[model samples]
Every structure is written in C-alpha cells, then in structure tokens.
Target chain A: MNKIILLNNRPTGKPQASDFKFTDENKPEIAKGEILLKTKFVSVDPYLRGRMSNAESYVEPFKLNKPISSGCIAEVVESKNESFKKGDFVSGSLDWKEYQVSNGKGLLTIDASIAPLSTYLGILGMTGLTAYLGLTEIGVPKKGETIVVSGAAGAVGSVVGQIGKILGCHVVGIAGTDEKVAMLKSKFGFDDAINYNTTKDIKKAIATACPNGIDVYFDNVGGDISDNVHANINRFGRIIVCGAISAYNETSVPTGPRVEHFLIRKSVLMQGFIIGNYVEKFPEGIKQLSKWLQEGKLTYTETIVEGFDTIPQAFMDLFEGKNTGKMIVKI
Target chain B: MNKIILLNNRPTGKPQASDFKFTDENKPEIAKGEILLKTKFVSVDPYLRGRMSNAESYVEPFKLNKPISSGCIAEVVESKNESFKKGDFVSGSLDWKEYQVSNGKGLLTIDASIAPLSTYLGILGMTGLTAYLGLTEIGVPKKGETIVVSGAAGAVGSVVGQIGKILGCHVVGIAGTDEKVAMLKSKFGFDDAINYNTTKDIKKAIATACPNGIDVYFDNVGGDISDNVHANINRFGRIIVCGAISAYNETSVPTGPRVEHFLIRKSVLMQGFIIGNYVEKFPEGIKQLSKWLQEGKLTYTETIVEGFDTIPQAFMDLFEGKNTGKMIVKI
Candidate 1:
C-alpha cells in the first residue's frame, strides 16, 4: 500500500491538519512510456497555502479530495520509458504519494554526483529559479544600490540576499527572529539584518539598516512590512513582490495603508513576480545559480524531517516560522 | 506696473483664494542673455498642487510669500538674447505675472503659424509630454489590449485615452461626470467610458466596460477609483501612476484597500510615472505628438480662464473636477 495526502477541505484562515487527509492506496500499474517513481524529498512551501484555497491564482487551485502535488525529488523504481531508466533520480512537480506514475513529461533527471539530491528540490529547484529570475528580471538590482529582502530567512529570500551581494549591492535582510537575522548577516554575508519581530518599529529599523535608502526591495512578505519598505524606497527604486504570505490565509481580503502615495513620491517601479513568467530562461538562471553554488559563493540550508507522515506538520511549522530556510520532507 | 501672484500659504486642503496673494511691481529688466516676456497662456495643472506643500518632490515646493510659477507661453516683448527676438512666442516655466524676464535657458521658441500660441501651454506642452511618455515608456500599451484612463476629462487623461486608441487598444475612460464620460467616448475617441460618480458598483462597472480586462491603466485619479480599476486588471497589466488628484487635497495620508494581493495574483507592474524621468526623450515624444496634431490624428480641449488673477482659481478648480481638459489662465 502507498500513502497519499489529499486536500480534505478548503482552508479558512490558517490551514488546519483536518484540512488534509492521509490515505493508503495500492500502487497503480504503469503503461508503456511511463515510469514508477518512489517519493524521496518533498518540498513544502508557504505558497501551497494559496493553492489549498479555490481562488484563481498564477497556478491552479488544489481541488478538494484530490492528492496534493508539489516540488518533489523521487527515484525511478520501474520505467517503460526509454528517456528514464530504473535507479535514476528525477525532480518535478509530483503528487504527495509514496509511489506515483509519470510519463517523464515535466520531470528532469537529477544526479547526486553534482549536488545533494535534496538540493534539486531547494537551491537548484523552483525556489532558486524564483529568486534569480525575479531579482534579475524584475527588480534589476544595480551595483552600489541597496537591496532589502523581506522574509529574508525564507528559502527564496535567503538566495535573493546572496545574489544581491554577488551583484555588488548593499544587501539588507529582514527576518522575524533575531536568530535568523544573525544567520542572515553572519552566514549569508548580508551587509545588515533586522529582526522585524523584535524591532520596535520595522520601518525605522529598515531606514537605519539601509542608510542610503532602499533601491531594490525583494519583498517576500506583504502587508505593513511591504508598506514600510515603500516608505523608505529611493527614487527609481525597483520592488520585486515575490510572495505575500502574511495575508494568504485570511478569510477576507486584507486591507492596509494605500501604496500609490509612496509609489509616486519616489517614482518607484513595483512589480509582482513569479518564476513561470521567465520559464524560457530557466536553464540560463539555473546554470548561473549552480555555478555560484559550486564556486563557494552561494550556500543553502534545509530542515529535513524523516518519514512521509511528517509532511503536514512540517508544512504547518512553516507558518510558525520554525524553519530557517527550505523545509523538506524525507521519505 | 506688473501684477504677480504669490504662494501666501501652503494649502491644508482644497486650495483657496487666501492661499494666493496678488501684488504689483514695476516691469523687470532683462540681462544680456535674457528676454522680457509678457505672459500669454499659463498652464494651471493638478500637479501644481503637489508643489504647493513643502514636501520633497520632483520639483521644489512653492516658497511662502514668493512668486508662483508654472508652464507658460509668453510673447517676447523685448529681446536681450540672440536666440529670441521681439514678437516671438516662447514656452517655458514662467512665474504667474503679467510681465517677467527669463534667462532663455529653459524656454523653447514656438511658431504661432504652426499651432496656436495657447497650445504650447496645453497639447504641445508638458500635458502632452506627460501622457505620451508615461504611456509609451511605463504603461507600454500594446495594440488590441484594453487601456483605462482615470480622470478621463483632465489634461493628461484625455490625451492618454486618445493615444491608447491610436495604438489600437480598446480605450476605456473613467470620469466623475456623465458629460466628461460622453466627451471621452465622443470627442476623445475612447471606445468606452464609465461615469464613476453615477455608477453604483464601480468595480462591476469597470468589468462591464472593459470586458477583456484592463491591460494598461493610465491613472491620474488615484483612490477608490484606482482600487476599482485593479479589480479588472489582467495578468501582466501595466499601470502608469500619473497623478493622485483625488488624494492631493487630503491633509492626512489616505488609506484604502492594499494593492500587493492583486499585484501578486496577476503579476502586474505598477510604476509611478512622471515626464521628468524620460526628459532625455522629450524631443522624440514632442515630435511624435506634433506630427499627430498636424495630421489631425490628435485633438485637445482647453478650459481657458481670462486674466492673470484667475490663475489661483483655475488651479483650485482642478480639485473640483471642473475642467474638461487643460485648465489655462490667459493674461
């Protein structure tokens, strides 16, 4: 029997454990040109919270009673497809199941030789691609300019901060905890870091950290934090809105201080960003990111929990800010 | 004697007559590199309201008890500069006075035979340039896309709608009055017009008017009107934040529905646009606008108030939405 997780209900506010169901099903047979994949590493992300609701988004909403799917690393147990062979590792947006069948359509062959197999789901996966593309294409952080990363300890934010430093920018990170802020400056080489939770005024803290004013804002968090960032934005500032996890689980539409005032004040360019918009340049971005990782210029951290049963709890822990970087489930 | 208006006070809300002081002085002399100018047509714009306050902006705020200045077309009564001669009509940012002297640096000599002298203060001036550069550079309206213009009857919005139509976009205009809405559709060639004042549900009205969804929004009126426009914005939508006339009078920072949620949902690009950022490309834009005017492809409306004393009232009327087009004070 193979275990699978299903979206049991539409989450109202914060997603509850009852909203998901774990069920056992017999592994299905694979026809010709199909490969049997055994789940290895599952990437649980904050964005999954959006998919749990049936709201129209960049990606399709997860249907109720259907098996949940996300970025996953798996081993090919059996393959009738010539493109994929047994014993090979692959990475793709795969279903949350112990065993699954794939035609190798969207799956990419992964090798443990170059990097850790789990990294294919983290630093070398959608997370890395998102950070690279959004900053380079949308934010366009110029050298000598200040780049502030909100949710700076998160998987994507951590990478964005590193890339900002590599681009010869003044990198400032904003995280929830002092521990994460310490990691951002010490481990990630960020010029400065602000623990937003401990700070009396996040806006004033941002101003103190970036004395010259923010030029490039890689915003992974939205709401007042984003508005505060806007208050400190410089003329011709570029804000790459990657995620708004703060308001994702709210039952009703969230409201806050209007943005148009600040936008006009600084003549800023604020754009909402997603990786899919630059899918065509994924190979180019991945190549650059991989090179940086190999050259010791880039580093990543993952909170890996053993067993597929721990997947839901690991996801719930993300909202509580339990994980420092990428949160992955090991099977 | 020369009559001049000065900023008597920084307006707290809607500008009043008490905010301006009229004084008399002897006609000023011009230096060797300067020219004497008799004010013809002075452009009283909504943006001038931003400069009335002592806030950091693209242009310096008006000084208390000092002469107020704006875009003006004046006839050269006496020439001390070789570049300009008597009887030549030149357009420049000039003080609100019946007689003033200029250094001839920022002034552009205009031919009365080519276009009416008053047009230099309206269609062929900053009003035209703002609409052109904002749409072309920031909004980037594509042919066959839907473009919405707020403050549709005002100086910049009226031109933005016409340009959208010229670019083959389905143009929709949002105005406060049914008369302005009618003018937008009939006179400005806008495909559709929404009267936000009478419209019960502005969001629904926008959806009905722009069935294809808004791709490019030239927003001159920001507030609930802009928030409503965001409801119908398509993926990859580009918003040109030209003016926030609605909130300009409010002493406090106006609050409303937050924008980041919709920005993320649609991957929209919202940029605060001013003509100054593209100052280097002014000649190119002006040439294109001039050609359009010459070919009869472009048309403009002006609400010209007579006498120099009307300058303050003309500017104040902008906040009331009294002008159907460019508001100009002729002396």
Candidate 2:
C-alpha cells in the first residue's frame, strides 16, 4: 500500500509530529508525456517549516491538507514519456508520498554511481547550491579578509566557512556548542571558532579572534549573533543573511540588538539571497562542488536516520542543534 | 582682536554653546609652506557629532582644548608659501577660529567665478558629493526605479532626492513636517512625499505612495522610519544609509525590528557611505551638478544663518528638525 503524510494543520511553534499523518493512498497514474516515480528518499529541510507558515515569503505557503513536498530522489518505475524509461533514478520536486507522477518539468536523471543517490539531495542539491550562491554572490570574499559565519556546524554555514578558507580569508565561525565549534576548525579548516553558549563576551571574543575586523559575515542564525557580528565588521563589509533559524521557532517577533546604525558606521553591505533566483548558476556550482569532492578539497558529512517515520524526530533535532552537518532521512 | 571658539569639552549628548567658548589667542605666524586663512563660510554638519564622541570612527575625534575645525571656505589673507598668495579664495580643513594658519597639503584654491563661495559648502562641496556618490555608487538606481529618500529636507537628503529625479527615478521623500514634504515634492521634483510625523502607519503610507514598492531607499533617519522603509522594500532592493540623525542623540541603543532577516526575504542590500571616500569622482559630480544648475534642470536651496556664534545652535537645530535644506552659517 502506498501512503502519504498530509499536513493536517499549520504549526504554531516547533511543529509536533501529530501535525502530519501517514495513511494508505492510491498510487498516482502517469499521464501522457509523464513518468511514474516510486519514492526512494524524500528530503526534509528546515526551510519546509517556512512553507508551512502563512506569511510573506519568497515562496508560496504550503496548502492545508496537502502532502508536504520538496526535492525528492525517486526511481522511475514506469514511463509514459519517451524521455524517461523504467528503472531510471531521477530527482525532482514532488509530494511526500510513496509514489508520484511527474511531467518532467523539474525532473532530472541522476547517475547513482557518482556517489549515493542521497548525495544529490544534499551536497549537490538545493542545500549546497544555497551555500554556493549566498557566499559567492553576496559574501564576495577577498583573500586575507576576515569572514565570519554563524551556525557554523550546520549544512550551509559549514560550506560557507570552508569556502572562505579556500578563498584565503581568515574564517571564523560561531556555533552553539563546543563539539560544533571543534568540527568547524577540524573539518572545515576554520581559523577561529566561537562556541556562543560558553563565550563570556561575543563582541570581545570576535574582536580578539579577528583583530582586523570582519569583512564578510555569512549569517545563518539571526538574532543577537547577527548584531554582534555586525558590530565587528570593517568598512565596506558585506553580510549575506541566508537564514534566521533562531527566529524561525519564535512565538513572537525576535528582538535583539538594533543593527540599523551599523550599516552607516561601517559602510557595511547586507544582502539576502534565495537559491531559486540563481537556477542558471546551479549547474556551474554543482560542477565545481563535484570536482572539489573528487579532489578531496571539499568534504561533507550527514547524520542520517534509518526510517522515513523518523522524519519528524530528525527535523526536531535540527531545531535543537543536534545535527552536526546535513540531517537526512534515509529510506 | 581675533577670537575663535575653542573645543572645550567633548559632548555626551546634544552639544551646548558652553561646550565651546570664544577665546582671544595669538595669531600664530605662518610657517614655511603655510598660509593664514580668514574664515569666509564654515560648515557645521551632523557628522561632527560623531567626532565629538570618543567612539572609534572613520575619522579622528575632535580633541578637547583645541580649536574645533572642519572643511571650510576661507580667504588667504597672507601666504608664506608659493602655492597660494594673499587675497586668493581657498577651501580646506581648518580651525573654527576667525584667523588661522594651514599647510598647503589639504588646501585647494577655490574658484569663485562659477558660483557663490558658499555653494562650495552645499551643492558643490561635501554635502553635494555625499548625495552624488551615495546615489550613483551605492543606490545604483536604474531608470524608472522608485527611489525613496528619508530626511528629504536636509542638506544631503535634498541633493539625493533631486539627483534621483535627474536619474529618472520616481522619487518619494519622507520628512518630519508637511512643509518639508511639500518642499520635497514642489521644489525637489519628488514624485510623492510622506510626512512621517503625521502618518499613522509609516509602512502603509510608504506602501500606498509606492505601489510597486521602494526600489532604493536613501536613508538619512535611521529609526522607525528606516525600519518601515526596509520592510516595504521590493526584491533586490538597495538601501543606502547615509545618516541616522534620529539615533545620534539616543542615550542608549535604540530598540526596533530586526532587519537582518529582511536581507534574506527581499534580497535587500543595505550599505552605509561617507562622501569623502569618493573624492576622485568629486570634480565630475560637481561638473554635472553645475550643468544641472546652469540649465535649470536642478534646483538648490540653503538655510543660511549669519555669524559664527550660531554654529552650536545650528547643529542643535538639526536634531530638532529646524532647517529645511542645507544649513549653512555665513561668517
């Protein structure tokens, strides 16, 4: 029996598992010029929580009573379209279901031999593309400049810090715990790492670490962390705000240090970016990421859960800062 | 006897007349390569507030017990240097005193034939350069883009709004009073105007006036007005924070909405700029501004106060939102 998880109601805070229900459902039929895909892996991301809420956002909010969907790796079980044949592995955007029918608009064939099929859903997927686009286009790191990244142990932040180091910048990362901070230095080649939980004075700590002051701040955790980062930026500094995970689960508008004045003080440039807007650059970014992976210049690690039923638990772990790198649910 | 106001004390808040005291002192002999300058017109700007504070800034803070000084148009009464002679009009950074000696390094001979010598302090000086550089370099306005300027009646803001209109942007300005707003629309050619004081909801007011959403927000007042302007910005919006007069006097760090997250949502770019950084482009900017003035394509206005003792009062009046356009003290 095929089953799907429906978003029965909108979440107010950290979404409870009860908000989703998995039930038996009919397999979708493939129309002409469409292919039938059996789900192999469905990627769950923190950004999906944003889609659940009804707010002004870059993408449309998810509909109530509809199955949550994202970039899913699937197997083409049957095909009505000449482009896709049976037993081909493909990746595309679709509902959280056991099976799906695709018109091939967003679908792309994947070579499983390159790595694992799941790698496409993480490093070479939307997550990696986001890190690439945000850092390259917005951060614009220069050699010898200091680059600070928040949420440094997470998927995007880890990559951003690593890229900063690769570009010959003095990379400093701020994480929630000692373990994550260690991972930033050991795994990502970050020059300096700050565990915000243990730090006595964030600004002083950053100033001590980066005596020259920060040039680019890749902000993932927006709140007080962003404010402290803003205070340390040098003249003509750039801030690429990718996510505000600290504010995502908030019950109210999160208040921190007012940083509007910092813009004028440092002549700092702060910008936000979404990956969807840079679709044309994705292939080039993926190609570079793939080369780095093959050459051992870039490394990625994921904390995977065995069963699809653990999706909600894995997602909840993300908010609690349990995952070190990309958190993926493997079937 | 020539007397000048000496910088007596660093001001904690709004500087008082007591912070400065007129003292009779010896007219120091002009050394080799130095010239004696009699102040013709002295500039009192909002940025001087920063110089009074001990806070680390782009320029050195003004030292107590010394004559406070800045960019002023002066007449070379006597010259010990070959570069400049007596009776030559020049512009340079010098003491606030009636007569002083300056080395030739920072001095430039002013041409009085083209425009008024005081115009060098407004439309042809640092104020004009600020408006030109901030709009052209950072604001990067495209033709027909809606340019929103805060503190529209001030020295820099007025020039920015007029330049925006010249650059083909639909200019909208925010001012403290209806009169200033009226001036923005009638005198400066702003497409629309918003009196922030009278408006119940700044966001709604900006939204109603700019239906397409603000493409570029040249922020002069960085408080709630900036927050409202930032919230109403469109995708890929650019915000050039030129000054934040509203927050300069605040005793504590002002509390408001977190704007770093908006960078992610709108792909907004917020940058701060000082006009001094673009000195290389100054002559070109002046040439264009002069052409605009000569052709009657642009209109310039100034609120001139006679005498030098009113400098403190002029600086204080800026905080109270008194002056309509470039506030200048004629010596």
Candidate 3:
C-alpha cells in the first residue's frame, strides 16, 4: 500500500504533529499523458510553515484533507508521457505520497551523476538558489563589507554565509546553539558566529562581531533578532528580508522599534525577496552556485531522516531549531 | 549690525524658544571673490528638528551656540565675485543671518523672473526635488495603482500626492486636520484624504480609501501612522521613507509593529530617501517639476510667517501640523 500525508488542519501558530494526517492509499495509476512517480526525497523548510496557515502569503496555503506538496525528487516508475521515461529521475513541486501521477509539466530532469539526488532538494536546488539570489540580488555584498546572516545554521542561511565568504565579505552568522555557531565558523567559514540564544545583549554581541558595522544583513530569522541587527547596521545598509521564522509561531502581532528612523538616518534599503519571483534569473544563479560547489568554494550540510512518516515531525522540528542545515526526508 | 539666530542648546524634546538665541553682530564687508548676501526668505522645516539634536543623521547636527542653516533665498547686496552681481538672487544652504558674506560656493543663482524668491526655497527647490525623486525613484508608482501619502498636507507630502495624481495613480492623503484633509483633495488633487488625528482607526480608514490596496506609500510621518499604512500595503508594495516628523520630537525611541512579516509576505521594497544623494539626477528632476509647474499641472501652498524672528516659531509649529504646505519665514 502507498502512504500519503494531508493537512488535517490549518496550523494556528506553531505547527503540531496532529495538524497533519497520514493515511494509506492505493498507488496512483499513470494515464496516457502522465507518469507514475515514486517519491525519493522531500524538502521540509521553515517557509513551509507559512503555507500551513490559511493566510495570503507568497505561496498558497495547503488545503485541509488534501495532499501537502513541496519540492521533491521522484523516480519515474511507470511512464505513459513522451517527456519522461521509466527509471528517470525528476524534481519539482510534488505531493507527499509514496506514489503519485504527474503529467511531467514542471518537473526538471536532474542528473544524479553531478550530485546526490537528495542534494537536488538542497545545495543544488531551491535552497541554494534562494541563498544565492537573495544575497547577491538583495544584499549586494561588497568586498570587505560586513554581512550578517540570521538563522545562520539553517538551509538558506548556511548557503548564504558560504556565498558571502566566497565574495570576500566579512561574513558573520547568528544562530541559537554554540554547536551551530561552531559549525558556522569551522565548517561554513564564517569570520565569526554569535549564539543569539546565549548572548544576553544581541545588539552588543552583533556590535562586537561586526566592529566595522553590518553593511548587508541577510535576515532569515526576524523579530527582536532582526531589530538587534538593525541597531548594528551601517550607513547605506541593505537588509534582505528572506524569512520571518521567528514570528511564524506567534499568535499575536510582533511589535518592536520603528524602522523609519534607522532607514532615513542611514539612507538604507530593505527589500523582501522571494526566490520564485527570480525564475528568469535562475540559470545565472544556478550556474554560479554550481561552479562554487564544484570548486569546493561552497559546502553544505543536511539533516536527513529516513521514512515517509518522519516528514511532519521533520517540518515541526524546524521551528524548534532542531535542524542545523537543510532538513530533508528520504523515503 | 547684523541679526542672527543661533542654536542655544540641543533640544531635549520639543524645541522651546529658549533653545534658540537671537544675537546681533557687525555686518561683514565683501572681499575679493566674495559676495554680500542679505537673507530674504528663511526656510524652516521639520527635518531641521533632526539637525537640532546631536544625533548622527543624513545631515550634520547643529552645533551648540552656532547659527543654524537651511535652504534659504538671499539677494546679492554687493558683489566682488564674478558669479554674482548686485540685486541677483541666489539660493543655497545659507546661515541664519540677516546679512552674510559668501564666495559664491555651492550657491545656485535663482531667476526671480521665473518664480517668486521664496518659491526658490520651496517648490522649485529641495522640497520639490525630494517629493519627485523619493516618489518616482523609490515608490515607482505605476498607473492605476493606489498611492498613499502620510503627512499629506506638508511640503514634501503635498508635492508627492500631486505627483501621484500626475502619474495616473489613485492618490490618497493622510493628514492631521479636517482643513488639511480638505486641502489635500481640493488643492493637491488627492483622490481621497484621511484625517488621521480624527480617524477612529487609521488602518481601517486606509483600507476603505484604498480598496485596491496600497501599491506605493510616501511616508513623511512615521510611528503609528506608518504602522497603519503597512497594514493596508499590497503585495509588491513600495514605501519611500522620506521623513518621520512624528518621531522627531519623541524623547524616547518610537516603537511599532515589526515590518518583516508584512514585507516578506508581500515582497515589498522599503527605501529611505535623502535628496542630497540624488544630486546627479537633479537636472532631470528639476526639468520634470519645472514643466509640470509651468503647465499648471503642479500647484503648491506655503505658510509664510513674517520676519526672521518668527523662524524658530514657524519651525516648531511644523510638529503641530500647523503648516499647510511649505513653512517659510520671510526675513
């Protein structure tokens, strides 16, 4: 029997395991213009939390009692479509199911020889593209400039810090744990890393870490941490608002110091970046990210859990700061 | 003897008369390569409030016991410099003095034949440039889109609303009083106006006014009013951080709802604008403004207080929303 996960309820604040429902299903059959795909890897992310809520967001919310979908790599088990063949691997937005039927519409035939199939859901996929495009397009980091990344140990943040380092920037990472902080500096090659959870005064810690002042801020975690980063921001700074994972769990509206004074006083620019909007420039982003990965200039880490049943728990673990890098579910 | 207004003390909160000292000095004679200037119109602005404090800003803070300077119109009383002759009017960042000597550095020779002398310090000058540049460059309002201007009765806001109309946008203005609100619709050609001071709920009022949602916001007043604007902001919105008159006088830091969720959800862009940064684009900005003014598409209002003695009072009144448009003191 095939298994599938569905949104049992629209998550209120912090998502719980009960919010999702998993059930057994018959393997979906392939039609004349379709292909039957066996799910290989599923990408679970903090941004997925936004889609779990019934609010207007960058992406549409997942419907109740329907299959929850995200970026997934699948193998063509049975093909009736001319565009895809049996045993071929493709990656695209696919549903959470052991077996599903697709018309081969948005799927990209990714090569397994170049990298691991699971890496297609991470460093070489949307994760890398988000980091590369968001940092270069929005952050616009200059050589010798200080670049700070919040949620620094996560999928996008880890990649962003690596890219910043490659660009010859004074890259700094802010994460929750000392272990993640150590990984950011030792593994990701960030100049420094601040454990925000341990730091009594995040603003002061940022000030010390970025003595020259933060010129570009890659914000994945927003709220008071972002507010503290603003305090240490430099004149003519650029803030790339990627994700507000920090505020995603809050039932009440998050309040903090007004930004107009910082913006006006410093002549700063803050832009919200959604990677889907930069599809036309994906080739450029992918090419650069690929080159860096090949040259060993860029490195990535992932927390993979085996089995289809671990998907919801893996997603929920994201908010608890459980995952250090890309959180992936391999079935 | 020459008359001058000097900053007596760095204001702690709202500026008082005691914060300024009117002093007398001997009028300076013009030397070779220098011109004697007689102050004609003194431009008093809310932004001057920022300069009065020792805080670092886009512009330098006013030094204690030193004559405060702003965009002023002056007549050439005597000329030893080739650039200027007797009776020629020039505008520049001039000192707050009845008579002063200049070497014609950084001064723009104004044509009284084109507009009034005081108009050089206003619509034809920095105020016009700020509105035009901040709105077009940052706000980037597209035709049929909704544009909202806060502090819509003031100098920059008034011009911003007019320009929004010219750009074929649905222009909405937010001001403090019923009179200013009426003027915004009647005189400034704003499609809708909201009296924020009297409005029970600013966010609801904004939502009602902008049914299509706010595509662009020209923010002159920050704090709660700006927070309300963000609530009504649409996806891919643009906010121009021109000024924050609302927070200028606050003794403590002004706090509000955090902007990350709003920005990230919408893919919005928020940029702070200072007119000085766009000096290279001044010619382009001036040409557009000049054409609009000449064609009668753009009209301006001024609250002119008589004499240099009223300069400090006129500036202080800006915080009270006393000025309909540009606040000037005719010396």
Q: Residue A160 in model 1: shift from native, Å?
A: 1.0
| Candidate 1 residue spans exceeding 4 A from truth | none
* Cα RMSD for predicted model 3: 1.2
lDDT of 1 by residue, B97-157 (tens): 9999888888888888988888887788889999999999998888899999999889888
Better of 2 and 3 by lDDT: 3
Give one digit per residue, the lDDT tens place, for model 2 in B1-331: 6778777888767778777877877877888888888998888888888888777777888888777887789999999999998999988777888888888777878789988898888888888888988999998999989999999988888889989988898889999898888888888888899999899998999999998898999988888888888878988899888898888876667888787667777778888787767888988998888888888887778888888778778877878888877788888
Expressed as tens digits, the lDDT of each residue in A1-331 for candidate 3 is 8899999988888999899999988767776999999999999988888888888887998899999999999999999999888899999999999999999999999999998898888989999999999998888899999999999999999999999988999999999999999999999999999998899988998999999999999999888899899988888999999999989988767888889998999999999999999999888887888898999899999999999999999999998988978999999
Docking class of 3: high
Instruction: Name the candidate, 2 or 3, with the larger DockQ value.
Output: 3
Q: Give the range where candidate 2 chain A is weakest over 10 consecutive residues by summed lDDT.
A: A251-260
lDDT of each: 0.90, 0.84, 0.92
Cα deviation in Å at residue B77, candidate 1? 0.7
> How big is the positional error of residue A252 in model 3, measured in Å on the Cα after superposition?
2.1
Q: Which residue pairs collide in model 2, if any?
A: A272-B263
